[model samples]
Target: MTLTTPEAPAGLPAPTTPGRGRGRSRRAGRADTRLPRARARRPLLFWPVTAAVTAFVLAFVAPFLVIVTNAFKTSADYRNNGPLSWPEEWNWDILADVWERVGFTQKLVNSVQISLGVVLIAVVLALFNAYALGIGRVRWRNAFLVFFLAVNVLPQEGMVYPVYYVFREVGLYDTKLGYTLLIGVVYSAFGTYLLTSVFAGFPRELLEAAALDGASRWTTLWRIVLPMSWPTLSVMCVFFFVWSWNEFLMPLVLLISGENQTVPLGLSVLQGQYSSDPTAMSAAALLGVVPMIAFFLVFQRTLTRGISAGAVK
Candidate 1:
């Protein structure tokens, strides 16, 4: 007996076999089921997280609001009106007065110079150190990293006096160069700790390829590693700059003269023994903060990408 499969109707595709059709239907059902579940959970997940983030932002912004509102008020008005209240009268002259009285321009110059110097020296040293520890086949690499980390945790107060005495003996005390070097050294440990992980995770294949091309380690680092790692490097620079800019203890102890003191030190000078002007103080504080806020805004995109890159694999 002869038998033949039936033909599909004109212009219609052949029907799938029962087993294959069942399998496809099952997969389609699964996809359909999963989509609704995900869609259903999205709002449930989104609103709570949104509410939480909003609360966190408000908490952070509340203090800045207080400072800004009070900064534009007269001291008497600020005192009478309470921190939460709006200023009765806007006194814009307070900023100019505070700026001149605190010698903010000179201190700003000092801060800018010191912060740039610290960032330059610290980032260069950290890049070299991280390259050695992370990429090179060095002995006791883990131990060296641990040592760098330990240096970070060592309290500044513990070493500050000894460092002060040493700087005094070496005639580096109360000098811009001295203060810059001191802060650079203190912050380098943190930079090393941060960059080492980034360097260590770099692809060994690239390093090997560079070696095969007869590129020296320094050449490979500058040409290959550094170009690719700039996001991380830039983030580190921003952090180190901010830290050095705001550093109080080292600059306070090291930079004694009015000419040498940084913005923080200058702000302290503004709060004189006989004068208690909250409005002026607030203006000075706001002035000191403005540059940092501007810096962060300028580098925010790079900073965000760098931080996220570091956080991920």
Candidate 2:
């Protein structure tokens, strides 16, 4: 005997399987749960972080705004309207006047020479010192490193008088080359310490492989280590350059001649015993900082990579 199964009601849809219904319900429920969580998280997490970062950036940029805006204003406008106010009239001539009257053109050349010299000398010395301490297996390396750290921590004021006397006796005082040497020696201590860490973290396997291939220590350092360490070296160069450029105390003491003065010294000449030109000084300052800003922009990526690489080990 054959039996017929019951059919669905006319005009009604066929029923879905239990598994299909369950899956649809589960998916719908999950979507419903996720949508609310995402909506809730938006206000609680993302917006606040964005606002904080924006505020921090604005705060950081506020000073540059003051410097740039006031740089174009006249001294009267600066004094009457205050530092934060917009300029009544732009005195674009102040920049040219600063360049000529303050002898900034000559001072800039002096600064470039001194700063480049310091960076060159410091980097070369630091590289040799770091390689000796880190890769050459030199005895008493820790003691040497400690001595450098000690020198780095010593106050510049403590050594200034003695340095002045010595430079004068050696007939090196008030000379740009003398100041360059002084800054190079002073900054090399920190550079040595920084590069030592980078070198010590060098891959042991590579050094061993180079040794196996009969590479001498100098060859390994020059070919293998230096090529790999260019980022850190570039960072050191930027640091030393910036420091030498901005250094006022050493330049003030070591360089006395108007012709030999750097940008900072030239800017000081803008001030008088009683009165000062705020607008021209601002222009000079803006000019003075441009090279540093340009340098950082050019090397920013390398600087970041160097810092991150050094931090890794």
Residue range 168-242, candidate 1, lDDT tens digits: 999999999988888887788888888898887899899999999999988999899999888889898999999
Q: Tens-digit lDDT track for model 2 on 77-189?
A: 98899888999988888888888898888898999999999999999999999999888769999999999999999998998899999998999999988888888987889
Which candidate leads in TM-score? Answer: 2
**Candidate 2 accuracy as TM-score:** 0.88
How far residue 19's Cα lies from its native spot in candidate 2, in Å, is 5.8
TM-score for all models, in order of appearance: 0.86, 0.88
Among all windows of ten consecutive residues in candidate 2, which has the lowest summed lDDT? 3-12
Whole-model lDDT values for every prediction: 0.89, 0.89
How much lDDT does candidate 2 score? 0.89
